[model samples]
Target: MSTPSYHPAAVALQAVLALANETEREVADRLGLNLTDYRALSTLSQSGPMTVGNLAVKLGATAATTTAIVSRLQSRGYAERLRGEGDRRHVHVSATAAASRDIMNLMRPLMDATNRHLESLPAAQQDAVAGFLHTARHLMQNHLNTLSTKDTA
Candidate 1:
C-alpha cells in the first residue's frame, strides 16, 4: 500500500479553486444572490448580452432554470431582458450597469493584487503562468463537458 503524490501544480490549482469558491460565496452573499444567480450575472457582465438559450448553454443550466435565474436577477435590478433591435421577437439578457459596477467593485481589490503580483514576475514567468492557466481552464472545461455528458447518459 503506497501513497500517491499529487503534482505541486495540481495542488496549487486545487488551492486556487478553493479560494475562488470562497470568494464567490462571499460575493454572492454580499450581492444578495444565490451562487447560480451570481454566476449568471458574472457571465453576462463578462460576455455581454446573450439570449436565454445561449445563457443556459453557457451556465450549463436548462432553459427553464436559466429563465428562473434571469427572473431573479431582473427582480434584483442586476439583469434585464431586452428585445432585439433588428428582430423584435429575439430576447437577450444583459447585466445592468449596477450589476457590472457591483461585481467590479467587489473584485477590483483582488484583481489589482493579482496584477501587482504578476508584474513582479519576470515577463517569461508571467507568460508561462498565463499559458499554464489557459491550459488549466481548457482541461477543466473538458472535464465539465465529460461530467455533463455522463449526467445526460
Candidate 2:
C-alpha cells in the first residue's frame, strides 16, 4: 500500500496565517478596532469601492453582517455607500479621506515592522517564500470553491 504524500504547502499556509493573525489581533486591539471592522476597512483600503456582496466575500462574512458593519462605518463617517454609477440598484462603498488616512496610519507601522522581519531573510529565500505563499493562496481558493459548492448541496 502506498502512503499519502504529505503536503507542506497547507501546513505552511496555516502556520503563516496563525502567526499573522495573532500579530494583527494584537495590533488591532491596540488600535481599538474589532476584527470584523478592521477586515472591512482593510478590504476597502486595498480594493477601493466595493459592493456589499463583494465586501462580504472579501471578509468571509454574510451579506446581512456586512450591511451592519457598513452601516456602522457610515455612522462613524469612515465610509459611505453610494449608488453605483452604472447601476443604482447596486450600492458601492468607498472610504472617506479620513478613513483612508486612518487605515494607512494604523497599517504603516505593522507593514514596516513586518518588512523589517522579512529583510533578515536572504533575497533568494524571500522570493522563494513569497512564491510558496502565492501558490498556497491559489490552492486555498480551490478549498473555498469546494465549500461554496457544498453549501449549494
Winner by lDDT: 1
| Regions more than 4 Å wrong, model 1 | none
Cα miss at 30, model 1 (Å)? 0.4
Could you give the C-alpha RMSD of every candidate to the true structure, in order shown?
1.0, 3.8
lDDT of 2: 0.82
lDDT of each: 0.97, 0.82
TM-score of 1: 0.96
lDDT of 2 by residue, 1-153 (tens): 997766886667678889889866765575467877877876787889989999998887899999999998788787899897687898899888888887778678878997998899999989998897788788778989999889989
Please give, for residues 67-113, the per-residue lDDT of candidate 1 as tens digits.
99999999989999999889999999999999999999999999999
lDDT of model 2 at position 5: 69
Give the top-scoring candidate (TM-score). Answer: 1
Could you tell me every candidate's TM-score relative to the true structure?
A: 0.96, 0.71
